[model samples]
Target chain A: MPTDFELTIRPRKGWQAVDFTEAYLYRELFAFLVWRDVKIRYRQTLLGGLWAILQPFIAMLIFSFIFNRLAHVQSDGPPYKLFAYAGLAPWTFFSTSVTQSSNSLLANHQLVSKVYFPRIFIPLGAIGALLLDLLLSLGLFFAMMLYYRWPATVALLWLPLFILVAVLATAGTGLTLSALNVSFRDVKYVVPFLVQMGLFVTPVIYPARYVPARWQVLLGLNPMAGVVIGFRHALLGTPASWAVMGVSIGVSVALFVFGLLIFRRMENRFADII
Target chain B: MKPILEIRELSKQYKLGWQRLRKAQNVRELIADGLTKPLRMLRGNQNHGPAKQEPFTLWALEKVNLDIYEGDIIGIIGRNGAGKSTLLKILSRITSPSNGTVVIRGRLASLLEVGTGFHPELTGKENIFLNGAILGMRRAEIIRRFDEIVAFAEVEKFLDTPVKHYSSGMYVRLAFAVAAHLDPEILVVDEVLAVGDLSFQKKCLGKMGEVSRSGRTVLFVSHNMAAIENLCTRGIVLHQGKLHFDGATKDAIQYYLNSLSTRFGTGHVVDLDGVGDRRSIVAPLLKRLEFFTENEQPLLEGLPTGSKLKIRVHFDLPGPTLSFNVGLGFNNSYGQRVFTAHSMFEPNRSVKESVGPQVFTCEIPSFTLMPGEYSVKVFLELKNREADAIEDAAKISVLESDFYGTGKVPKNGMFVLEHGWYLEQAADAK
Candidate 1:
């Protein structure tokens, strides 16, 4: 099974260079790492896979009570509980992915120092593991929708697009913070705060409609804002702000590309520094 | 076949010490540094202070060039910090070199350490696939060989159990089995073979032998001289970040040993800091080791073959003093241990703390070594626990001298024994 792969080693190139081909060659490694991450996450726990659903479901309950019951907030859809859970789903996925992926490199520093892989795979695998949790929790989201007598809309076909954008956003930020964590350990302390702060900015507890109309497009630049809004539109059949989604898609793509370049630039020094 | 790997002028420099902090920047400055630097560069207003270079750097490898062909098992031998691992790291692409290039043909995999990506929570079977894929094995390939790998590791019964529960020996075996089964054209192995029991080490060596015989080139780095001699046909010796020798295994080992011995023979008292082979089982108690004449003067140059020689060793004991023995090994220039003498065989000599720094002196009455270059190795053992051992601790050249009254002396053999030969009438041929 010898493919036409010839490895040439030279002095490191400029910061913009990344070796997608080499990463492609180790595609099996990526898959195995992802599998290992997913397996190890739920191993030896009592709740096991159910924790994925329980975490977001419980958070949805608390948020629905606090905002809808106590604060008497006006959510986009009719039932505030359904609206809050829908936004919590993607927001939870993004926050968890960012937090775990940021620490993935430090947790696997032993492997980083001992072996050679793309290094990107560690964080990518972290994201992959959280993605499984997101899917598992989505089942509960649909159950909640059914409980609320929400109609199944044809717009649900576009759900995968919003998920992709969410992944792109998570990966982009994850890779950048993870690479920075290697050199400046302060990134570790910053990640939790970033994730916590991201919740308020992502329009997860409330609808994006609560944000001022003039600031709505600017909120799309947060990437997760657009994803949460898009998820509501697809599932609840709310007319989506196409302009905001467009800005979000563009910002997510840009972040992903730039994150990859920074990750590759910092990669060569990882074995030495980490 | 073309060389499986060609390394040319490969060098790696490592910065040492704590890095100095630069001017603290606010988020505004940080964003400007990342995003707008290119546009600002066009306006030519990018005035900046000269960059402060690192004060010190240690070159781990300097201009090292090596070519490894198919089926070649080259043993890399070096003292600690000799750049053997650095060379392998460069070859494996674990780290990029500071200078030069390496052209590698065919698929290559490196076992810098066994079980590189093994997750403790994963089962043995799961880890086999995970580690295999990490080492570049395809999923189908791992599936095809999964049973073989398990059988080889002798962990078949524990396949479903997490690797964290596996005993260290079982863990190492399972890790090695996955690595050894990788079907790469070139394999780079480090000193991870030092793990496991002796029998398992032999088994791993046998597997490596099979790998090389199957037409794969292997670069093996190890400090075990016997293992190197037994396995590698070619040898490379690295000294202080440079390629010291590259030749036949026999010659390379001899050259490395000679260099160690010569460094020890410089006559000045050797301060025991990073001295001797790190692989020695000794616990490093030697503070100052030296050789002297009977008059306590430092022995320099050559001594007569039949002269009295005295060796003094000074050692510091960090813990409470115990009854210890000072053992010395004398080897001829060919790196063969001619004889070993231990103070345990002698009476009334116990290294005690009351003596301050423990000093032990051994005197040889009429040293019978033949006229040749020789080296000394010293070992300190207390209660049968080896405290320190320095191989090639000192070297002494022996000049020709006549021990017998006869005008002629025999020119062959290592030493002479005092004896009398009586002429007797030979029995009739049967």
Candidate 2:
């Protein structure tokens, strides 16, 4: 037999690093899974991709009415509608990615149990699907910026970096939760509550300036806090907070690494447990 | 020739009662359970109670060492829970083995289930790519063979339609077509041909034969004896998590059959649960088989020729009642099926649609089989699908008798047909 490719199988011992090369080899499958998720999300729906825009758009409306109109929450600079939307768009992306990817293994139990691929792709593909929705909601944010006559600024170049931070944070939390969700189904019930509570803890509805100055550092630990503030600074020319961004980026990277470790440790048992 | 795959001391242990024990009522209890896990491990033997006589762990597979060479089509056969699937899973890397190691020298692809990653909402074209990629084909390869796959499945016209709308036949065809096109150095398949229609099954068997002929190694697990005997060059029988026999396909099949008869001893009433040669996707539905005389008494002595015979089959049906058929096949000592009596043959005799344990008795007014040993095969079908089939379920000896109420008897054929010969003169003879 030709010995071009050799594979060794044995009991995995202790903690192992994620097999990035194996995942890379199955990149086509990962891409297909992401495509499938994106296609299935919109297929047969009355409103197709509009659901992406409508999710955050509707949330922004509700938050503006309650938090801005009634409570008179501070926006820091831009109109509360645009400011709230800048935060809501990425928040929607983060929350939905977390929820969907957390359940990805359970939902595709057949795939996980029957086929061999980098199981991490199951959750990562789910996050990849929501990236399109993030883009869609960002389109609505750009339109809102136009309506509010917010001129373009070079700070907009930082938008991708902020988006990368959000992706990292989502991947970190989603991978950890998805892996845990395989063994302990209680993660399913806990995730929604966590995401719901997450919105208040992060600065999705109000500016980080509204919080006490001392606790602002704690708020940056949430990762999405810095993402929301960064989105406003990038899109609406609001003053950027490098310290909070540094802390959030650091937290996001740490979470991502921690999540990968957990995922790699638990992935071997996923097929049996799931 | 050097073997393409080598496995040494492969074993897998599953925690049997852990899922039940892990059923924590709430978060606090779950946390407490986690905290006390190490302590409980330390006190393991002391915690064993009378009610927990069964061990908490099950060894699904023991030290199974195997070496498979290239171009060998090996049929892995055993009863249900015989570690066929566990071995395949370990080879496919779907689950890790608890002990030992396996080394493979070439690319391997395993098809445990067809249409595994197929999304009902995805179009046929989309599913083809998705399923192909899931089966470990590169996108470029799928793109190159896209047309061939579509044509082979005969779904060219509906390639853009969602798979949910495709007929069951169409779906299976498309799925198999994609799988058939996969060209891996080593391929492992389990029971996938059990789906689809008979003709499609034939086509799939043909495809498998072609694949084996092309010199790629194939490992197949199946309950269909004929397919295994026809397609495999070698066979491996796993009995109760250990490698029982491994040799040429013919010897392996004989070994499996012999082992099965001994495992479930011959008797008037045989429990079907332990019967090895069953082809059923569902759980053990046909529970037992009992043989009786004309008057429903258990037959102890050999059945005399021309005497009435009755066979009773006991089965349990779970869930709502559906249309089903039971059949009994009589095969001579040579393994040639002489005749079959199927419930579907007499459609007017509707079966009672009651749930749970039920008995169906079939009676023949005159036993016509020539005095010889014949094996009885029982099968049950639910909605035209093979729910359960057990070959050589029971054996009966037919005693020689005056079948025609004459002194002479025919001894050559398997069956005796009633006939009268009259001396007649043809025109030329007259």
Candidate 3:
């Protein structure tokens, strides 16, 4: 016999409840959505998953030309190629995931309006698809490290923690922006500008050590700054700043929590507005 | 058994103005309002009740109460803006109410539309699972019923093909098939059957009937009164965001029909009220409508069959009207539109663009309406603007007359056709 559960619906009087259990129950749908996005992303492309590697690779070449060759930007610790690649890997993942996930609600408005599932799944699935690209791009970073004859270090194990930091940061901003996009569609226009501007401020093309010492902590407030620095520290054995990592982690977690709060509150209005 | 679902004082309010702003940033005002709302509430500067202070507020559903029992099939019937869709959306949790509560005793699956989450590039097999999961079916359950669904939709050959390649009919068939197989304590369907052809529609209705007979509750919403009367044990009528009637299907349909009958009465001129507000700044407003005979006599109540008919529509324009269209529809007593005539389609016969206080009259040389009770609906459209329509604006009954000059009246269909019968005798037989 099928199990029965009672449901009561009323006007939302105050702050909304983020039902973790309900989200857990829909884990299968979450997995399916992620899988669907991944499959469809590369389905028609001739290069398929190769585009993932090509994007950051091409960006690395341009950064190497412009920042390293033309401007003579100091690597500060590692070679410019290795330094730029490390930052680009995490940066690409964060930017792509944030941009895609922010538009997830609008892209899947059909499902949002027609069915009842945790609306969080759409953006999360978008992030999940980008995770594949992140992993693939990380492979190129390692190859560049090998070409530079860089030795592996125990710090490599800390890479997953930074990856977690990146995920949290992306999820927070993505979910909040996605919810906002449902109501104020200007988020769609705002996101591209955000990605472009974020690349310059995020220490992707330059190292954190290049910044004046006094402003380093402020740079850490940009969540991607810490993830990029942490990735370089893990992969290239660069100088590590516990203070900056702490600030970056704090900012990412806070952004995530704040985004979640705004997302949950705005979720009920999505179907009506979108 | 106790009722499976109970709804009390359910209402939904919507803001109408912000939706018109085509740009995405316009929603920022609403967000800003929401952000500052709490502080205002704390300071006692906000209105306490569910009072709509905004001029553009629309009460899509208002103070609606309903209860559904197990093994019951309830049909929701209403006009275009009568809140049927809003009620379904609230019930399915697609949107929440502004007040009151709805309680459900068991699992409910709402097929507000078939194939809600279908991806065009996905193969038929994949879409089955995807759509099934979206509709609240478990993977194991969808797998178990996969063969049955494929057979019902008759798409076994295209199982591996992407749905984008399938014809529209095939798509709808497969979508409805997957939706039909969902096993829930209650199912809510909204006009999904209107898409498919006749045979497919019948098949879908049959499937719903089967589901209902298996002791599951069903809530159906449709504009088709015949389908509601045929399948539902109970009927609900909503009018202008309020529950007008709820009872047996027969009585509910009768009540709805009675409401249509009251829209227009036996008079030469019908003044419309309660249609809608004069909201548009540029569009012309329909001021007066009248019916007449060929000799320009005021038509009242009944008109003889085969008599010439004329209709005069008076309009009030704020300024010179530009590229406007007016149309009329005739429906039988059963709430089915028989035929419609529009000025847009007959540009040569249409009225010229002009300013305020203008009357446009349409003449029918031979009115061939069969003897029966009928109603008229008026529609007005301005160039590149949303059309305003008032359904069942006037009611006129066609009286029986010797249209054939043989003291007999044609009693079949909605209208009569002029034709002559020819006969020949064979020479051999003679």
Candidate 4:
């Protein structure tokens, strides 16, 4: 028999039990969800899983042409392809996660109002697909790094922590928007605009050094700001800063916690309102 | 011994719309009473609940409390929105209660929807693994019962086929197969068996009975009384989100049926409580519902075993006919509609047309229904046939006796037939 119990590691009243162990136990399911998301994305189409690889690659090419050629945007040291691909890595993950997770609730509305599961799974599943796509795109990033003849550094070891930070940031934003999407209903339309606006507000096309030091911490609070900076430092041989990574991790965790609390509080109202 | 589940003082209160409306109404009452009228003035103009205002709010489920011991098969019975599904959802931990503490122990799994978590792009075999994992089953256990699940769902041939390619029936079959095989200490299901025709229903019900007999706790929600009566040892009746009755299965069913009769006197519906003061209630009953026989005959006496009895409920709505569904059930001498059919899910009709009144009929080709005393119960729905339910416009019957002796004829079929004219033409017979 399956285990009947999955207690939250720490369940507080009004607290959303992230149920990490429950999530961990459900890890196989999570992986399958990622796989299913990949399959579903390309299942019935003329252009199948290619969309996963094409989405970020095409976006990178456009940004490379427009910003690198037309705008002559600064890439600290590496080639424009390397610069754009690095930014595309996490940005693609973040943007797609937000898109999928937000729509996840409405898409799974049939499952949501009928059966029960950790609702966080909805956004998590949405992100799961993004992560799969990210992994696929990462393959291209590796091929480019080799073409540029940039030897990997130990800083690359720190990449996992930065990805974790990206996940937290993505989850934090996704949770807020998903729950909101169920309510105001218009968040469905607004999320795309915000994501588009975010591509600019973030330093995806530019370097972090361009921003004055006085504004570093505030930018760090953007959460993904540190992530892009961390990725550049890790694979591109840029200098890493302990202060920035620490501050960003702290902000990411805070966003995650805050997002979780608000989601649990509002989730009770979802079935009725949605 | 601890009951498998316990619910105490559970009450869920919902805001109809604007909090301001409730506040304004409260202020009106306070100023009239002259008690705490000053306090009402201080908290002025703030919305108490939602941002919008509506005339009324439905209490889906009110203060309800109950406990279930381990190994109890409890059936929840009620009309569409009477909170049967609400209670199951709360129990399944899908949604939290606005007010109430539910203490449940042991592992929980839900057949609430077969393949609820199934992904369309995943193949049949992959979905089994996916389903088991989601239900908290370990890989080893799922593998052990892998063949059993596939054989039961009867989709072994399409194990590798993407579920998106499967027909609706195949989807349900595979989904139900996985849910049934994944063993859990407690299993919760809600009307999934209603899919895949009645033959499949009996097969699934048999599986549930087997699960129940194995000492696992089962919580079921369904409007089908015959299925409930056959499968559940205990009954729970939820009306307007409150527990109206909780006891023997027979008693709970009786309570539910009686309530329907009281609110809808015989078949007349439209109980206006209007004090004869309003212009007219329009009694949305007779204008929408009626009974007929297969040969275009109006129903007078109960149809014989081989005759089809049709129920046509005609409704004229404020908008085009979005959906017109009528549910008919076979009620025994005890006044219960045992086996019910609905037009809301007609196999060959356009379920989505528009808004308005339309004539909906459930045609039983030859009421292969048992030869027991049966009544025809009619229910009309609009938005989602189940959501927009009209329980009043049904017909009662003092059906013909068991001439074919097929009533209560064991747990085997969706219909009962009065077989006649058995013959064989062969040279050996001469």
Candidate 5:
């Protein structure tokens, strides 16, 4: 038989580029992984996918009581509940993506060690599974807007870009941590701590305007800060923070590049160690 | 004709203590190592210097070369840690090699594990697609063969049921069914046949044979010598991370068997102290195993069929008195357990309240195993718990003998059973 598809295996040198073409070829596998996760995420649970809506919804109610009523935080023109829901939806997506993807490789260690596929799909598929949850939470946010009689504005067009930023940020952190978790194992413990601290640091419970102007750039470096603020500006017609958004996009891209580098460098060692 | 796959000087080196060193340590040890590093450097300890010292390493595979032709069914065999798995892992691209190169001319899918990504919560139908995708099948290809896979697995009634609910046999059948549908130009399988029932195993072997007959290459790694002898046209033996032998299947199997006998000499008393391949969690208690004829003589040449065989197990009991049963299993060269003799199965034969060095003798009245080399497995069980189990503890060869005194030896089956035939006249004939 004549040779049609040839593959050569050899020792890999330092810091290689991600094989985008190969990853693209395995795109169906990526879809299957995502679909599997989504299908089974709530199979035996009593609430099924209602948990996806209830998680952020319940968290929003609690934040509305604690931060709005107890702490007297400003909602920046929208109702405290609406303001909190907008921020909570995106925050949930971002945090869940980070937490889930960080452990994705370890959870699927069998697939990692026993079979050959683009391992990036494990973490990426984890993030992809949460898109449904994000959509559900966003649906509740829009419904809340209807309850408040808030008009749907053209600025809503910017929602997809902010969601993309959140996804990229999650992917960046997820790939790096998942790769590290394979080796260190301590990353598993550290990931929850980091995500917990991140909830407070990101502008989820409070407006970005409340943070001192001097620290706004530092806060924007968190990546999700701009996402939350962007959600408010796009959804509630609040003032846009271009400085924070600019800083966030740069940080998100840099983290993604750095993560891709680390992940690919550690890719070959996963089967040996994991 | 050009070879479909070519490998040159393949090697994989692993650091021995790297995992230990990389493991998270307590803060005190971290501080101590931090404080002593510069002091050790100042004292001129060359061992601590990264440039002067090299971490301990073991080469799992070293400088192996081969050219595999199309339609060739190659069986790879080796003892534990002999690098057969490492070679397969490298070929499967699960792990990268430290050195060497391999050139493949077609799509190669490896089945290092049968159900690589089967989720228990997913339905059987869902897992089929997920497992197929993980094994590198395109979605369209799986869709095209979905009905055939379902029929082959015989799980049409439970296609929508979660895989966790499937019986073990059904699960293995479904997993292997999806794998059998894979139509890669080259297939690499490792011990997947160890699962499923006998009939299913035979069916899988038949499918593999069909695959090879279609002019696709296959690289198989298994410990079952019978399967290798039955299926493979060529065989490769790896010993201590190097290619020990590669030749025709029969010769390769013979060479491997000879190597095993040499490693474990055919002596009367086979010491178990140095045998590391034990499946025991407790301390090593099995000390020695000896085989003898019924007349108290060592059966050096081999045990003849129909003769009585005696096996003695010597063990040490370090703890308080405990009841335990010693069992011996006889497995043929195919790695199939033919029969087992357990002391617990015999009335009033259990050893109770035993401590210190002890010996247990098991006498088989008549060894009816067919003529073949069989490996013995010894296990020490306390009630339902296994205290110690060692496979391949000793080897016994059965020689052909006329058990019926008719000068005819039965060599067609796994065991020789006692039977007699007599001519009978029918009433109509009379």
Candidate 6:
């Protein structure tokens, strides 16, 4: 004897279609989380928002001095300051989001252990917070363009698509790291070293032209590779590098699908396992 | 009315070691290990067993099927580790079940914990919204009830202050107020209320009563017999992961008491060594207990209003010492400690020379007892020291007298001694 009104919720696998309504309902929490992250990062700091721009600005000066001066690296005829800053902006956002989001579960151990909500929001919140930092750094990127009397192109409007690809790459990796961080804490220790290695490998300080034309497509599979080349072309009024941006968009979307699916599947085990 | 929550068969399992033993040295190793788990699953074993599988899971709640109707204030009483919290966790959606499923109708809220979802850095008002969301409330509803929540929590002056700075009273007040004002279709609360001050506890219990009367369901877990009897209309007692009783509230409380009395005597279980396995072939050991009149009819069995009784113990000690202390402690049926008497505290040193068969008696001359059962605990201590040699507690015996004097039943708490008072206004008037 059963009532006809019983509503049984069927549990699903990771890649299964998600109920966006649930995530949408929790949007306020997500927004608050994003805002909360923004405030905490800037609060009580003497430099305030300048801290955001300075990280990349100082990195550009160091890279320009070391790579452009000592290593005598070529930057496709543009100033080294613009080259390094262009590459550093998206790279900084990607790396910081990974570090923050990977440790997101550990940082919110209390919330993760005790409450139930969309777990993706924690890593996504990191992305939202890092975006503010990226925006602040962008101002410096423009100031550099003006300082060097570099020309701006309409191609800059297309920067948003490159940014989307960068974010997809970050979100894909961030979600994987955040979910895995709950169980295997080793992800935290490995992130810094990987970020360092990524900078050199992605040609952030040097020009991609040095990487030989045939090998560039395979190199762009790094995702950030495409983001760097695209930012260089967009800001310097150069032609698009189809070989690099094409590989970046492809890799980013792939990572996005793969990361999101694995993350959703593993989110169910979080409360119990963590 | 249909049950607001139904749990068919809920189970949760966990694995303990690999996360600890196999440390990941780098991202390559981490990804390699993560990728391997799914690969193993694809090799035939499914990965759907964590919620369903405990490596050696012994059904925390096996085939547990129940229906909780709307507006029914049901008490969940159980022994420790009796699956009480597990059942609530499954119903609360804190965790999903392994084998069976639970269908919850309407919004289900659980006050299973206090300060849940609270950010230490967030202000009290902000945490209210955060806490409300955690309990399944919408943002608009939280905004509508925000003022009432602050008023109920008594934190009006400190709404902007971060909750990490609040005192225990303030923290609990706000935590409980958020849960109280959620006004969900069902509320499942655990035993966190034992921490608050007495008056606030009474206020919380009163609010729970009001919540019940307003046609909502509540599943309450508490060791307070009086509060459970006062608030819940029904009770479900769990014993070792099985349903012991599911009936009227009074009968359920009685069933719990009877079972406890049978197992642990009327007194609470006292362990002198704080060790569970303490058994020895002794001289005069403190073994078991019962309260009896001179005729020994189990003192609470139907005695006169004002009568004397002797509490007897059956025991022997494996080893004997000179003047090892033996005494008695008393607690009300509700498990509150009332009084204690020991040879160590008084001028008198009553020592049993031979330890084989010892009998101790406390004569209650003109015993003034109310109508409820009273539990007496036995203690053997190092006389005058803050240590026990052997102890057994919560042995119950009834005092069936009209000593409460108002003809009302004795409430489950420390007894209020009847002392007649006279106020003669100074023989007035010259």
Candidate 5, A1-274: lDDT as tens digits: 1238888999986899889998988889999999998998999999999999999999999999999999999888889898899899988898898899999998999999899999999999999999889998888888899999988778899989988888888899999999998977878899889889988998899888899999989988999998899888888888877999989988988898898999999999999988
**Model 2 agreement with the true structure over B293-392: per-residue lDDT tens digits:** 8677788779988888888899986644668778999877545577898878874677667778888888888889989777788888766766678777
Considering the true interface contacts (CA pairs under 8 Å between chains A and B), give the fraction that model 3 also has. Answer: 0.73
Candidate 1 per-residue C-alpha lDDT over B1-430 given as tens digits, one digit per residue, 9 for 90 to 100: 6677888998898865312223225676666555654444343333432211223356889999888887888999876568888888888778899999999888888999888889899999889988888888899999999888988899989999999999999999999999989998888998877778878999999998898788788888886788889889899999868899999999999998877765763564766666745223334567777666646667776777677788778876555545667888887753557888899877666545543467788888778888987767788875576656776667778888776758676577779778898987779845
Q: What does DockQ give for each predicted structure?
A: 0.47, 0.47, 0.50, 0.41, 0.51, 0.18
lDDT of 6 by residue, B1-430 (tens): 7667776755544333221222456788767766676554344333342221213223456667788878889999865556788778667655666667778776666788778777767789888987887676778889999999999889999998888899989999999999899767778888867767888998898888999899888899887888899999999998756677999999999998777655452232232223232222121246555566645556545445456666555555333445556677665544444566655665565555554545555656545455555555565543232222232244445555556577865554434465787877686657
Candidates 1 and 3 compared: the better one by lDDT is 3
Candidate 4 C-alpha lDDT tens digits along A65-166: 999899999788888878878887899889888988988888988667766556777788778777777778878888888888977888888888888899
Off by over 4 Å in 2: A1-3, B19-55, B269-296, B299-430
lDDT of 3 by residue, B168-243 (tens): 9999999999999999998999877777778898999889889988988999998777789889999999987899
Model 3 Cα lDDT, one tens digit per residue, A153-210: 8999999999999999999999999988886777989999999999999888987877
Please list the C-alpha lDDT of all candidates, in the order they appear. Answer: 0.82, 0.86, 0.83, 0.71, 0.86, 0.72
Candidate no. 2 TM-score = 0.78
What stretches of model 1 exceed 4 Å from their correct place?
Answer: A1-5, B19-54, B265-268, B271-430
Q: How good is the docking of model 1, by CAPRI class?
A: acceptable
Error of 5 at A169 (Å): 0.2
CAPRI verdict (incorrect, acceptable, medium, high) for model 5 = medium
| Best of the two (3, 4) by DockQ | 3
Which pairs in model 5 have colliding backbones?
none
Q: How far out, in Å, is residue A140 in model 5?
A: 0.9
For model 5 chain B, the run of ten residues with the poorest summed lDDT: B16-25
lDDT of 4 by residue, B1-430 (tens): 8777877877655554322222224555646535543344345444333222332345666878887899899998876557777677777666667677777787777766677778877788888887777766778888999999889888978999988899988888888887888677888888776678566778898998999999999999876788889989999888767788999999999998887656533332333232111111222332544556666876665566556666665555544445445565565543334677866456687756655546666677766654454544444454443323333334444334454565633334435555677677886875
Best by TM-score: 3
**What lDDT does model 5 reach?**
0.86
TM-score of chain A of each: 0.96, 0.97, 0.97, 0.89, 0.97, 0.94
Clashing pairs in 2: none
TM-score for each of the candidates: 0.75, 0.78, 0.82, 0.74, 0.80, 0.71
TM-score of chain B of each: 0.59, 0.62, 0.70, 0.62, 0.65, 0.57
Worst 10 residues of 3 chain A by lDDT: A1-10
In what order do the candidates fall by DockQ, top score first?
5, 3, 2, 1, 4, 6
The fnat scores of all predictions, in order, read: 0.79, 0.89, 0.73, 0.41, 0.88, 0.28
